[model samples]
Target: MEEAHSSRYSIHPGSTKMYRDLREVYWWNSIKKGIDEFVAKCPNCQQVKVKHQRLGGMTQNIELPKWKWEMINMDFITEFPRS
Candidate 1:
């Protein structure tokens, strides 16, 4: 996918998806390991890799609310952000 605006820097999936559709959730854990492997192959990390048809489905509870500010919280998270 071509980035709407860019300067040859590869777009992180998180940034691109959010910019185009705020509700789109690009779950890192939900995608295949191969997606990361392919991106890592990009020497500049600026290549916009094409999206392919994924063949699996997973629904997780995601117990944490709004993920803690500085941590990857999957099981639980505090409402407050540390200062």
Candidate 2:
């Protein structure tokens, strides 16, 4: 369990992926629950996991230019080495 959870075998995978990995070579009742508990308590996993609900930062709106080409921004639509 330690090996799968934090040793070289692990990359701090989420509980679901950990469950799947364990399922391939091991089996026991409450295995999923155990993995969930382990992952929830894992400091490294908590730190590395993405926070889906947290906003990154405050957003500011861009002021529109009153005249055309006043704030011109261009992009190359064609592929590189254009003919």
Candidate 3:
């Protein structure tokens, strides 16, 4: 069971993929639950899995400008033909 869960071919797939792969040649009463537990304990999976939390939120400065247009910004764009 440990070999299947941490084997090279299995490659630490998620619980679903592990369950399906194990089912190809093995059977058990709590296969899904066992696979979930195994994956949850897998160090490699924990190390590389993407976190599911939101990233940092947007932020804006609250400082005031001393004069008009002091804090304003502009961008100039020019287009040229491709020859």
Best by TM-score: 2
lDDT of all the models against the reference?
A: 0.45, 0.84, 0.81
Residues 1-83 of candidate 3: C-alpha lDDT, one tens digit per residue = 68876778767778888788889999889888988988898888887777944667789788898898878778987796778
Each candidate structure's count of clashing pairs: 1, 0, 0
Clashes of 2: 0
Could you give candidate 2's per-residue lDDT for residues 1-83 as a string of tens digits?
76788877677778998899999999999999999998899888887767834767998898999999889788877666946
lDDT tens digits by residue: candidate 1, 1-83: 23412235644454434344423544445344535454455544543434443645787675565646745537665788878
Rank all candidate structures by their lDDT, best first, as comma-separated numbers. 2, 3, 1
Candidate 2 residues lying further than 4 Å off, grouped into runs, are 52-83
Question: By TM-score, is 1 or 2 better?
Answer: 2
Specify the poorest-scoring 10-residue window by lDDT in model 3. 47-56
Q: Supply the TM-score for candidate 1.
A: 0.22
lDDT of 3: 0.81
